[model samples]
Target: MKNLAWLSLGLMIGQFAYADPIENGISFTSGDWEIVCDNTRTCRAAGYQNEDDGTQQPVSVLLTRAAGKNQAVVGQIRLGATDTDPTDTEVQMKINGQNFGKVSISKDGDFLGHLSSAQVEGILSSVKKTSLIDFIGKQQKWRVSDKGVAAVLLKMDDVQGRINTTGAIVKKGALTEANVLPALPKPLITTVKVKSSPVQWNSTQLSQLRAALKATFKSDDDACSMLTDPQEGASEISITRLNDQKLLTSALCWRAAYNEGYGYWVIDAKAPYHPVLVTTDASDYQEGKITSAQKGRGVGDCWSSESWAWDGKQFIHTGASTTGECKAVAAGGTWNLPTFVSTVR
Candidate 1:
């Protein structure tokens, strides 16, 4: 439910982005580092170079740990634009000027392979204090800030119930990892099979459907009110059979410079069509699932998305996530961080 303005303000003022109505799990940020714990309790901590530091390119790191006793804390690194080939270049991490070792290149551009356990441990110890984190490559050196990293990792530890345990990332103690909380099982969702392929409404049905949906809007200024008169010739609607008794519908709701939105609803196939509006800002619909993808800004550097699925009875939120802050790291943003996750059967 957050927008570009709120995201920018939170980062600038060093305010944490708490879980919003759209997001179900824990969403927190502090300084140059932030962490997200999904519904399954898996935590991901991302740290970046201070945006104000213009002298060098952006260098970032990702640390991930699933909820459970003794789960390994995996580390990943990403570098900003460079002149040389990443494969041929040897990228090494240096904590406070101490060389840890080189990290392997990854198939994903700008991202290095998973860090070795030793490298991860070194990072866990160094990131807690006012240390300078650096990733060195040919003609490139990315310095990540240590500010707020300790607080973020501590929060991760707290959420995972790892605090005061041997496996705690920030507050390690004498307690055994067995004392830490176990990972929760992923929520299971049995998807409804599509009874038939997609089909659009005829001209007669289209006009009636539009009028019916317009009636549900709060006012003439509702964003989706564009359904009456789209920027194009007219709005379009798609109908698909959800089951023998119900039908799924989609229609063009609004448009923007680089992105668009759709309205999704569940309705009866016959007259007395009780259109149950799902969302007016959905991005796409397929089979028995509905999804929405929105950009933090027009550049497409940062993004967020959520999904809903039919489970025979009704649509349920399946997942919601966002790439880390829009630091202009890459086109789709720096990381695939999720605030909510689920396993759909």
Candidate 2:
């Protein structure tokens, strides 16, 4: 974290457009340029030119009067080289010269992290360069290059060039088809909080279980897409066929053990017996992992969710280890479900 001077040269330029008091001038000895606005609210500076391709690019820095006397410094801050490219650009925000976090546009032009923010000031800095060009391009090169704001801004002209070459198609001049596929189904959570011993469910838990089953069924084809196979698959709920046609409607319910984006399937099932819980892991051929969790209370099971990750081998259940375990095997991501409705006649 480089501590910027309260009166950096770049801050002046940002203030130039907002407040009208900015004045541009040359640095006498540093040979760097500066912009000062409103006498005190904003200030900016550029670094001495570097000789790369005989191009002396400016490294712009800016500072603004922040919430208190503490000033907010922002603009392009160079970190180092990428695997191939020599320079990587990051949008830096600081308070009173101390570093806050940054959002770096990798050498590959990928925006990494709106990362951790120490305060609101950091958030503001992120918004400033959400779509900056040079800050994004320099990292794509296979060698060292200047990653200054001016350089990036210059490169943005290339992006504009591409857009112009493609030529924008007016919607009114084009015939577009409507989106017919349904939206992704919403997640359903169980409401029962069953505790130790004789467990039972309430309307909330039953409703949640119904919704969860619906989502699971709907997710069948979608989940199957995650598998290696190309065909539709079957999924099932397991319960013992206890009595001879003794009307049994057991719903599955269990607390999730992992989080989202991990390999897990959230299920809501329950049986007539006490201590009924359901938890499972899911994966597809494409998007690897997804996990789901649910917990029950004393005779009142309330399912909650947690997440976990997978490494193509086994599921890394996040949080801590649990006694409850359920698995949702994926075949092209479609559930290879076991028998669902098995009862004695």
Candidate 3:
């Protein structure tokens, strides 16, 4: 199984200074507006053209909205490494009816939008600044959506609103809908269970072994750093027998994948015996490749990292995991799953 990390609302969204006027290429609905944020941390309004529903445009904008909130917008967008020039690369934004906007992000990679100032004041008119609680008491439902940019969606959440206020923001009376970007789907990591010898392992030791397994899987894939999202990648594992003896010791192990081909590792030292470093089918990794020096450290076909000796017991180390929303490439359908790594303990 893969280690998929789900980033809760608290970790995904952040606040930054607003910069640059709306660019010309980006067009918004007469009443609807859209913004594109690229990987470089730049946000900008993308230019667009609207036609009747029957129009022949093959590429349509996809949009996600916050629940109860009106007119969703793309909150944060990212650019590809090759896509250095925002204007040249076409970033798509969609929510509700689709085609919210299409345009290149600015050179600096940032964009911002307000409802023409007039719209903001109009929405605020109903609220009283003194007793703000009563002024905007209506609930806002928000959903997040965007095109698949590969690794860009990692660490992003859709349902969570972006705000620094201590309390939730509510709308009272008939307030025009607010448009926020759709949240990315959470990624799924691999799930595994490690088995150690019952005689040699205690509950506390088992828990410690489990933790060690989790760490091994994380270090191998770079999933911790790359943001493992199993939904977008593939993963699988195998168990290898180490020693040949009358009372044999065995380890239940897991090796999974995320990203293009990043793999995760999970292991359990079921017995006191440690397995000898052997050849792995994996490439870019091998036996005895461990960075930390100790006895029995090695690498092989395994790609991510290597195994380590933890607490007098030998354990494997892999990579970290991450979560984000993504659309399936073939269907263009929405997908979301929380943390990918299932409990191994």
Candidate 4:
């Protein structure tokens, strides 16, 4: 038993160490169960089984507790991708061939049930003594490994900051710290230098600036439409002095769907302005460099961002950060934080 515990600890720590930080999700294996924890510290434990016909199905049961909620843990039997949608149905559960009880499946194909802490303790007792536990839904059957299920549940409890009085499952030593996922770095904000005596543009100069911007996008009708369209939000164009000799101009147009847009542009130098099209989804200028971020669509999504520094003639990519798969949770949008993949300066 001690050897088994040590082996489990080794596997868990090994996974935590080398696994890509970019993959904001932390996963570890105990017996046949694989446990995954998201940035919000909500975790799920799952195990898969293959059918006799060699088709792999989501015949596994998944367990998770709500973030920061220690009242109850929920269990769900995942329906395979190709499985027929289940209407309201009853799922039968058994431990060591003895009937446990029935859990209700919702209309939207969700096979879920709740377990109080006492109920979890009862199940853990059975799992420690049994080898097979079965989940029989109306159209699916999952035979779970008892030891694996027990180990995963213990780890899940740890991840949610729960302590199991029975040392049977609680991790000891360094492995205990692995329960909590690391917090993501704060968002980077660019600092703009404010000028006491800012440069002001007159009507004629402003007209020349507008003409120059329209000319820059002349080759692309879609981009030019942003400056000419009245329905679009007010033109977001501005000019600033980069230094005593260089001047900077920028324009932005926010679109409708998905908050799409004709992104901002930064034109360096003066009239007959040399425009350098900045194509990042979002950007900020600070410390003589442009930092940009591209947000992902959904939780557990990956994001890519970079910083570019201008070197006299052109902007060069100076640093970048990318994250692995991450899923967002609703705890103040904490899961939206991204794990750094790499940083190069």
Candidate 5:
């Protein structure tokens, strides 16, 4: 999964001041407005705003047009992390102070609404003339600039194959009405039974384990430091047998200075002399599989986790989940489980 560390509203928005220029797909920029085509060829235009005190607001507006005929022209308004119930409120859009429409909030806490082709054209035309768009929620407002929107949409059409080299043009049309939004699959829940008893290692065994760990970190200076001088009271080492006679040992070193940690050395019982260091930070191994997680904090906290199975030679990522909403503070939270990405078997 792509790292969701950027989901931290404050940290992410702050970095946007120095964000890199777009390199892939079609990209157009004017003033504070930016439009770009994604890998899927879908085009979206977005604008950001910061408060007078330099504090970043998580509010933004996205205008998207998908490829193909009759594709929906969507307007999306995203807000900062909040525990407020979005379903109880409404979001409105205005072009040049003229009311466009009102929309409901999505499960992701954003307001998304499909627009008619006529509405799209009107908004585009108004932006060119007035160069201002406003998105108003119950208690917040976002002002967007439309300076370069016209050129962006035209280029987007060309990239999406809507424009032919023969100077032909495809007109935008109304989208089909749909009542239900697509739903993401639920995460897999498995309760693997692990051994309740802990293993006791003798002095000779401990020495061998240390030797294995040393060999694993010999070429990694950072890893070596983490293993040797980990943060005070934030280190652990353990040995366990996954199967009848296959013992595995692992270690965790927390480095508070980095707000991160490291785990390494998955030694096989039969090959103790040639231990393999885990390339991925996975832990809680059981039944030939291990789980790993990454998290970030700011105005809201976000996390992504995955489970991988060891197939004798390598670990294969099998399942994954992520917290999509920053304010979803329930146990395990609301996870969006998309199809698993490929992993070497």
Candidate 6:
């Protein structure tokens, strides 16, 4: 069966942050505002152009804030870069038809200059009330709806425990900000140390082993339909030496139009060969890591990928992320938007 990790992300939204020592991540959406937070409690909230404003432009503003007392909220404006995207190199910021000023393009063309402290303060405060936020260019103008800005920012404040604090972006007061959550250091992961080499096993034994692995997919036939279908070969078992006590095994498990997945597991090197499954959506394995990369859609505009490191005894999840908002800016999207980050030794 395909791993359920990807689908689980969406279902896990709004689950409260800093609930434990280390959280994989959390996401939340309110109207046009969406927030994606990482393991370290660094959050990025993105607000998109109004969908019903007669014309939809692929413009968005990202508000990023790290967890800690008195951390500043940084904002950046991103204009779409797809074939259908805007070509304007400059844009004007307006709130309620009042011109804020010209937003100049920096050396990095993806954004106009990032909002200054004064601009950030103004926008956050304005969005909390009934205000029209817009960016007008020579050719086109885009409006970022304020419908959900207040709610989304409020949630951000809550997630970081900034609500009611002087540092809070939503509702600020004289409350002390000394107790706001501090930014936790990133979790560290070490890579697998042993070098893997292939080991040959009896052909009949391989077939039987493959069957056992397939049986592990007893449910989620719809999400992992390939498991229930018999199109895959049964003798596709592959075994490799992971360490002195365990053997790594893999078999073709699923196939899609532009990608295929293999199931990887670990078993006893000796007889009985009790197996423990790792993942069924793995696309490829190398040195000491397994990875999966799949396009978000047929256009190949966006992609999501994950990786695991075979750390000495067991496989450890190392990373999982999607490229930033899929505006067709690049073939696989433009920026690294990781939900999980770990340094491998």
How well does each candidate superpose onto the true structure, as a TM-score?
0.83, 0.20, 0.22, 0.42, 0.53, 0.82
Which window of 10 residues has the lowest lDDT sum in candidate 4?
328-337
Tens-digit lDDT track of model 5 for 244-323: 54455666654443245456455556536477666435546666667766664442345556666655554545665444
Instruction: Report the poorest 10 consecutive residues by lDDT, candidate 6.
Output: 1-10
> What tens-digit string does per-residue lDDT give for candidate 3 at 1-345?
112221322232322122222121111121112333322222232212122222211121222223223333332333222112223334433233333444343454332122223322322232222111101101211122222211122211122232321212221233233433332322222322222222344566544433443343435564322223334332222333222221112232223442122232323335432323222222232232222111111212112222222222233332211111121111211111111112221
Q: Each model's number of backbone clashes?
A: 0, 74, 89, 6, 0, 0
Q: Give the root-mean-square deviation of each candidate in angstroms.
A: 5.8, 22.0, 18.8, 12.2, 10.4, 6.8
The most accurate candidate by lDDT is 1
Clash count, predicted structure 4? 6
Residue 143, candidate 6: Cα error in Å is: 2.9
Clashing pairs for predicted structure model 1, backbone only: none
Q: Candidate 3: what lDDT?
A: 0.26
lDDT of 1 at 40: 79
Name the regions of candidate 2 deviating beyond 4 angstroms: 1-76, 80-224, 227-263, 269-345
State the displacement of the C-alpha of residue 185, model 6, in Å, after optimal TM-score superposition: 1.9
**RMSD in angstroms, candidate 6?**
6.8
Against the hidden true structure, what lDDT does model 5 obtain?
Answer: 0.50
Tens-place lDDT digits, model 2, residues 1-345: 122522342353333334232121111112222222221112232222233434222222222221112123343332223123234455544443445554554455322223332433342333223222122233232111222433222112121121122221101113222321111221222222112122245766654543444444344343322221224232223222212221112232221333222122322234322221122332211122233432333321123343333332232333221211111111111111111111111
Clashing pairs in 5: none
User: What's the true lDDT of residue 288 in model 2?
Assistant: 26
The per-model lDDT (C-alpha) reads: 0.78, 0.27, 0.26, 0.50, 0.50, 0.72
Which regions of candidate 1 fall more than 4 Å away from where they truly are? 1-23, 82-88, 107-110, 173-175, 197-208, 215-223, 228-234
Stretches of model 5 off by over 4 angstroms after superposition: 1-57, 60-76, 81-88, 95-99, 106-133, 143-198, 229-235, 262-264, 271-273, 280-289, 297-307, 318-345
